[model samples]
Target: MVGVLVATHGRLAEEFLNSAAMLVGEKEQMSSVCVLPGQSPEEFLELAEKKVEELDTGDGVLALVDIAGGTPNNTMFRLSMTHKIRILTGVNLPMVMYCVMERSDEMTMEELIEALLENGRNEISEFGKR
Candidate 1:
């Protein structure tokens, strides 16, 4: 299974992991990193890299961030140069759930990336009448 890493500002990543666990039971090879107030980008990057290293077990890691241009995303981008991981921004509950429930050890990196994007997109919709 592809390892999942949720990185975001404040406690958002932690909260998302908690919620995902509640919805789909506990997940293995999954972790979260939060960039707290006054925390430097380098600090966040170091923490995130540790988590990624811990979670990764041959199968690559998947990182989800709250914002595209925020500290977490930027740090992830920098780390991507040296790690075998993919970062997805604008992470939501559905996206987390999809990744947790759908990913498997047999799936390739490209397939996992496509599935994450497809499921995340499909989860969004206009509930009210058009």
Candidate 2:
């Protein structure tokens, strides 16, 4: 199965996973990293790498970060050089739920990323209209 990693500043990463678990039960090959205020970039990168390794199950890993230019996203972008991983930004509850439900060994990383990119947008609107 493909692993899903949630890395974000503060506790957003942990909460996103927790919320998904509450709705979908516990999921395997999923991990979360909360980058604290005082955490060094090197330290954060190290922990992130460990999580990526733990989550990888031959299908490669998908990293869902809070934002594009943020630490979590940037670290994964850098790590992608040495690992088989894809990174996506603009994480939300809907995306987290999709990750929990759709992630699987049968799904290619490119397919997953494309689906999320498209689905993630459709999931949002003016609070009334599509």
Candidate 3:
């Protein structure tokens, strides 16, 4: 199985996971970490590492950050170089949902990433008549 980590500048990461979990029902498919409330990079990384470890099963890990160049993204980047981990930033609800919903025995991490990118790029129109 592919391990997942979600990190953001605030509690958004944690909150998003919580709500998603609530809606989708709890499963150990992915793990998430947050860098919020003035937590240090080391702490955030530690949390992320723990989450990764919790979800890791010899398969490689993947990280999703809320924004690029931010603390979470930078930390994931630094960690990725030393480990066989894939990091993707600029996370959104659709991306998260896509990742979780697409988790399956038939999907590889690479395929999942591609699906995530495709889903992330989709545009929605909310101005239609209600």
Candidate 4:
């Protein structure tokens, strides 16, 4: 299974993981890192690297962040250069759920990343519109 790492500002990453667990039950090979206020980039990088190493099992990892160009996203981008991982921004419940449900040994990292992008995009809709 491809490991999943969620890094976001404040408690978003933790809460998002909790919510995903509530919907799909507990997930294996998944972890989260919360970037708190006043935290330095070096601190965040250290935590992220640790999580990636812990989750990675030679199948690579998927790093999800809340927003593109944000600290979390930027840190993940840098980390990706040194690790076998892919970074996905704009993370939401649907994206997390899709990762949890679709991740497996049979799925290649490229395939999983493509499916996640497609699923995350297709899930977005404007409510009360027809």
Candidate 5:
């Protein structure tokens, strides 16, 4: 029942949310923040913090970051320490898709995190070459 935030470098974060919405229509529990290149760390932090706060409405917030040790991930991590939010790095289409699907009245934070990580790890492979 927690809120979801997609924060990533460049336009990836916004694109993730947009693509998911396009694939399955509009959603209520999701939002995004895009950290463009050449932006100062302070700027990224402000934007990310604002996005997290906007989504944080008592159910808690979960931030899906694109890369570990990067600006977005690091900023999310810092916010997690102070806010009631969880962070799942290495985000992908599968992760976002699965999270939205499994999120419901009965799903726990642990369960959603597991689904995101597991689905994100699923290989998109071709069985036969064209």
Candidate 6:
């Protein structure tokens, strides 16, 4: 299966992982990283690289970040050139649940990326305004 690294600013990454774990139990090849206040982007990048290396078990890693152009997202983008890492931004609980529950070991990298992009977009909607 593809490994997952939920990296974001503040404690959001950890919270997402915790919530997903509650729904599907703890998953293997999954981890979280947070960019705290006063933390340099360079330092965060190094930390993210190490986590990616640790999580990657030949299936590569899927990194979920809070937003595009942020430190978490930007670092993962940089790491992508050297590692088999695919990035997805705007992570939410539903997306995390999909990654934890539906991501299969047999799925290819392209398929996983496609599924995540679709699922992430589909999770958002205006429900109460009618």
> Per-residue CA lDDT of candidate 6, range 41-107, in tens?
8899889999999999999999989999999999999999999999988988888888788888898
RMSD in Å for all candidates = 1.2, 1.4, 2.2, 1.0, 2.0, 1.2
Candidate whose lDDT is highest: 6
- What would the TM-score be for candidate 1 when compared with the true structure? 0.94
Count backbone overlaps in model 6: 0
lDDT of 2 by residue, 28-129 (tens): 888998789999999999999999999997888889999899999999998999999889898888888887787666888888899888889988888855
lDDT of 3 by residue, 1-130 (tens): 7777778877888777887777765446577777877688888788777777677676667788888899888887887776657888777777777666767766788987888777877734466759
Which residue pairs in candidate 5 collide? none
- In the predicted model 4, the residue pairs found to clash are none
Among these predictions, the greatest TM-score belongs to 4
Please write out the lDDT profile of model 5 over residues 1-130, one tens digit for every residue. 6789998888998888778777866567788888886899899888888887887767788899888899888998888888888888888887777666667757777887887777777645676869
**1 against 5, candidate with superior TM-score:** 1
Candidate 3: which stretches are off by over 4 Å? Answer: 123-130
Which ranges in model 1 have alpha carbons more than 4 Å from their true place? none
Report every candidate's CA lDDT: 0.88, 0.89, 0.76, 0.89, 0.81, 0.90
lDDT of 4 by residue, 79-112 (tens): 8899988899999888888777777789888998
Model 3: weakest 10-residue lDDT segment is: 120-129
Ranking by lDDT: 6, 4, 2, 1, 5, 3
Q: How does residue 109 of candidate 5 score in lDDT?
A: 76
Better of 4 and 5 by lDDT: 4
Off by over 4 Å in 2: none
User: How many clashing pairs does model 4 include?
Assistant: 0
* The 10-residue segment with the lowest total lDDT in model 4: 96-105
Indicate the worst ten consecutive residues by lDDT in candidate 5.
Answer: 120-129
